[model samples]
Target: MIENDCSDLFVQNFSFWKHLTDTEKQFLCDNTAPVHYFKGTNVHNGNSDCIGVLLIKSGQLRTYMLSEDGRDITLYRLFGGDVCILSASCVLDAITFDVFIDAEEDTDVLLINSAAFRQLADQNIYVKCFGYQLTAARFSDVMWAMQQILFMGADKRLAIFLSDEISKSGSNEIKMTHEQIARYMGSAREVVSRMLKYFSEEGIVELYRGGIRIIDKKKLHSLI
Candidate 1:
């Protein structure tokens, strides 16, 4: 029988699981396992690792890529309850780009074996639909990120990022180093520092040794 221990959390996001037969459910449970990651851990590298689907049960994860010179840019992020299929690159022939997965906070993940998942998909219509939907969702996220980089000005993008962070934390100040900000924005630390200095002079933000405080959301919005 399929283990029911984590079914509540698992089913909350994968409701189609309820449609499976006992044998199918048991098969999945047998091939699946739970994994935990501490904040800042690299869950998957864009290397030779056989990627598999991950369902986040708690905390957050980031999907990003490294550039030729080693700078990084975030592609998309997955929060609790999000399903990740791009990580299952072996079964999906269309995934041409490389990305890395990392935990943004302490996290819980349910790992499904890629080969097993492909087998299930081949046998179950619901599983096929779920897989297709997941692929479409992740592709949309990637396209959105590409648009943000190609069309949005760097200052505007940074301002929007800071504004969103401030709103998320319900505080004007956020803890982040220039290096961290540079990694997210896919720029150099010096470039990020210079931009922050410009924003400070413009009365949009204040920078300290370890973090930044937004001073004017209106001005930041105006930049965009």
Candidate 2:
């Protein structure tokens, strides 16, 4: 049986876990431990030794890569219910890459040791399937983001980001700054500010001191 604490944290939103047999849940519960990190803390850094997988329980996290010249490329954002396979390449091929992870906000996660996770994947069909699904989804998202950067201009990308935020929060008022948006879009803050000004002029969105309010969702979608 899954422990109440484990069920409450890692397995709550993991639908694939429901397909696992009782013995599988028991095995995982025995092997995993919960961890917490405060905002602005490094969960893991680029070039660190490969250790384990992380399943987010609450709050936000960011994965980024730093260039030799010291530029950050926002790689992926993790929210509640998301799982990050921190070192898949190293785990499989015995090599590592420069990929850093940090808590975007105060966060909680369940850390499943690599050996136990591998054993579970080997023995549990549901675990294998879940792994495949998560990998495929991550790959697809990266590809889509790359395609947007190649074919779409900064204005369109920023507009789409605002619209997405509106949809996510169920309100036009999004509680993030232009700098944060620029980080997510992999562009300059000045570029985002200029685009927002253009958007405001075009009646697509309204900029406030602390947040942005979407004025025309349909127009933003059309630009995207």
Candidate 3:
């Protein structure tokens, strides 16, 4: 069984939490549970599940929407120390689209109950500040994604995405499937495959089964 001791995490996430009364502190700690997700697992469904608040402890998650034809389009990715409220659309009332959260890597999160969080937000100034800040931050991110999709071409977007991956992993090699890339970029599998083939012919990238390696970073940058 996994240990649920997140008292330390609570303090680490909100240093001002130490100023609250012992009763309040204990209540928050007791309600803040730990959840672990294996790679490729769906952590939340905005259509059905009511996610309270998920504070990532480690690893990565992808929040995305599914099209009418079942194509998955990634909205944003979350990492450690990030607070996610879009998963709990039931509580927010502003979210209209169905978003699914899937674990891209093995992940651990601090899960707070929605009702408890609401109460805490109402009673504690620090909690309220954190909640509002998180909401605004997520909203900005969604807006940025909308702008990108609306203004940027797929080829340019794909180049930028690969550049980001290269910078993050510190290597030209990217271990991702064409299907996966399609989902991330909100494009069709056939389209992504065709685009990648074009990139390969142009010497922008070297393709392999289940992966791609950047050969000419300069060419990719120019496209973006």
Q: Each prediction's Cα lDDT score?
A: 0.83, 0.77, 0.81
| Tens-place lDDT digits, model 3, residues 31-143 | 77889999999988757887688889998999887767777778889999887777665555445656888999999998888877777767887777776677788778778
lDDT of 2 by residue, 89-194 (tens): 3443323355778898899888877788778777776766666677667667767777766788988788777877788669879888888888877778899999
Cα displacement (Å) at residue 217, model 1: 2.1
TM-score of each: 0.90, 0.80, 0.88
Output the worst ten-in-a-row residue range by lDDT, candidate 2: 87-96
Q: Enumerate residue pairs that collide in model 1.
A: none
lDDT of 2: 0.77
lDDT of 2 at 6: 82
Highest TM-score scorer: 1
Tens digits of per-residue lDDT for model 1, 163-188? 87887779999899998987876667
Residue-level lDDT for 163 in candidate 3: 93
Of models 2 and 3, which has the larger lDDT? 3
